[model samples]
Target: MTTSTGQPLAAQRILVTGGAGTIGSHVVDLLLEADAAEVVVLDNFARGRMENLAEAEAVGGDRLTVVTGDINDPALVRDVISGIDVVFHLAALRITQCAEQPRLALESLVDGTFTVIEAAVAADVKKVITSSSASVYGLAESFPTTERHHPYNNDTFYGAAKAFNEGMLRSFHAMNGLDYVALRYFNVYGPRMDTHGLYTEVLIRWMERISRGEAPLIFGDGAATMDFVHVRDIARANLLAARADVTDTVYNIATSTETSLKGLADALLAVMDSDLKAVHGPERAVNGVTRRLADISAAARDLGWTPEIGLSDGLDDLVTWWRHAAQPAVAG
Candidate 1:
């Protein structure tokens, strides 16, 4: 397999912690397609399903390996990291879910992260690319959020845990010479995303509701702005970051653009060819983000990575996949 740049990645042994997840599976796809020597999918299956792993394996054939494990288990993480050259850490409890189960979120995002880093250090892994949320920015003081934003305000515990894990990674890199990149991800969406239950992404949920002949609910007057980047773009960035010149500590993995909730509905409806009106729902316990747009100048300069797929084009692909995904599974 060749990267978009036509470079082969067959020399690298890569491990993605949440490799069966929506974003992580895409990362695995990019890694294996780019010709990675081995692509290990390390996931606990808490939120991710085995079918996702099988899909990637089916595409990449012998290049992909699935490992069922938790990042919090130090011994298991150490064993997994022992022979890997690069690690992409994407495991975490979701934002709203974390708000409900703060303790579990902390255990996965914080303690689990510490275990990953310590194992990397002990194994002398070459590089680690971690996923940090734009939620860490909280209610942005400025439009177009940058990497320079101060650590999370007293917002959700999920963001706080991401903040702490990022800080820890930086500290390890500085003190222990553990090469690392922390990617502050804005809203990421694409195919294989969970759309059934409480953990589904907003776009997937809306698509599911529309598919079910039901109107989707819009909270907060549908004015809340979010930065939606395609999962493939993020997967490209992870591969780029794996080999990118990394004197810097972190990079914001996003397009410097914002999308409102209404904009999202409009895009989805147009993509799905549906006229279903969205009903405004009561604002739930989860706090809404006012604005989210990344300052990707640093990502471009540092990782040589920037998103190329716009939301409209990506949605066309995503909706097609979702529609077909609604059908019964085909045997592998």
Candidate 2:
């Protein structure tokens, strides 16, 4: 498969930080499919699983190398980043985790990102593609938020970390001429989603309840909305960003479609063919961003990338995967 720029990924030495996670693993698989010369995965296993890289290992053979390491270790990061053509910096704590552990968030998201940027520049990597988040647009003032939107209202530690990382990338580009692209992902859901997490997405929680023939729960009348983009589409966006000539800019990677909790529950019920209705509960104290919809025109115009999977189709895929995978018990 050719990159978005129609250039083959063949013989390219790529490094994927957090490559064993959901979206990162998908990127590894796609990179291997594109016949990258060497795909090295550096993951500390904080949230990543070894099983996620099973398929890539089987298919990649000598082309793939899995390194058990931390991105915060400057020596380690520099060592692994050396001789790499492109770097995909995806390692970070979850949003909830970051909110709970501010110090860890600073170390992992802030310091770790600094290590990545410094190493990538020192290594003279062709391009660095990193994962940003829509959380940066916390409590957005406008709908269909664009990349140009400032992170003025962002209150969460996670959003602050992501915003800082983006700024660091731009600063590095200016000072060290480090080429980079940050993809601000929205609500990402698909196979390999972390259903066992303490702060899981509503989709995962609802699915677990529905599987047990229990009513799905929605918080605060289910008015809060998000832009749910599929993991596969996110992985594709990474590849497009990696190959595109764009640099020192951020792009929103989402479906450009808003989905409310109530709508999501209904869609999942229909997809799973369940008769259970959603139950409303008190709202949890979390990031209070009530609405999320992205303007993906920049990604489309620049990287030539657009989400191919609709919410319905993506939900069907998730449901299928959930049925076949182990169903872990989740707390309500």
Candidate 3:
């Protein structure tokens, strides 16, 4: 398949770090569907599961290779990256994990990212598309945060690490002529979302309560808002970034629409046909950012990508998957 600009992925060799994770797995499927020559997946299985790659494995046959390894292992990363044309670096610790284990966060986000960049440059890969986060904006100074928005308000360890990775990519591009693109993802939710993560747990918890005929709990006044983007759309953005001619820049991968906690609860209840109202609890001690909305025009203009799923449709999809699939084990 070719991008809007006619960049063909038909014969490209691709490497997706953390390729068994939620978004990464979807990307692997897309790459195979696009008829890429070869797709290699390197992951430690810490947060990613092999079951996520079942579909890709069935479809890709000999075209896909899954390596159970760590990105921080320099030798392993180098070996995996060799002969690869494009690298999708999606391996990293979650925000809550970063907060709990700062040392591990540095090793994985900083050191692991460095290892991937070094390997990609050494292999002379065409481009490296990496995952950044909305955490970098912390409490945005403006409503719909743009790509140019300063990350001055970010104070979390995870945000700092992502910011550092972006800077590191830029430096590599300037010094070694390494082409790269950083995608700043908003709240991503879908079939395989992390059920135990601090951010996404709300959805799982709420649904569980609703299933038991209990009220969904909401901390504070339910005024805290976030920009939720579906995992499929996020995966599509990664492919678009890979195929686009633009490089050495970052873009916000989000649906510009903002939904408050209350709004989200209402939507879920409506979707499930539940009569239980959301119960209000005490204010959260660390709410972090109270509001989040992204400016996705840059992505649309440059990558020719826009979110295709609406929140209601996305939530319905998640609910259906949850009902059919076994309860996901808690993510470490």
Candidate 2, residues 1-332: lDDT per residue as tens digits?
Answer: 73232234679999999999889999999999988999999999988887788889999999999999999999999999999999999999999899789999999999999999899988988888999999998989987899888898999999999999999999998998788899999999998887676766777878878988999988788988989999999999999888877888999999999999899999999999998889988988776889999999999999999999999999999989877874665575
What are the runs in model 1 whose C-alpha is more than 4 Å off? 1-8, 327-332
175-292 per-residue lDDT for model 1 (tens digits): 9978888898888888777766466667777776787777777876888888889888988888888777673377888778788898889888888888888888887656756778
Model 2 accuracy (lDDT, Cα): 0.90
1 or 2, greater by lDDT: 2
Error of 3 at 327 (Å): 1.4
lDDT of 3 by residue, 83-151 (tens): 998999999988888888999999999999999999999999888999999988889999789989999
- Candidates in order, TM-scores: namely 0.92, 0.96, 0.95
RMSD of each: 4.5, 2.6, 2.9
**Residue 66 lDDT (model 3):** 96
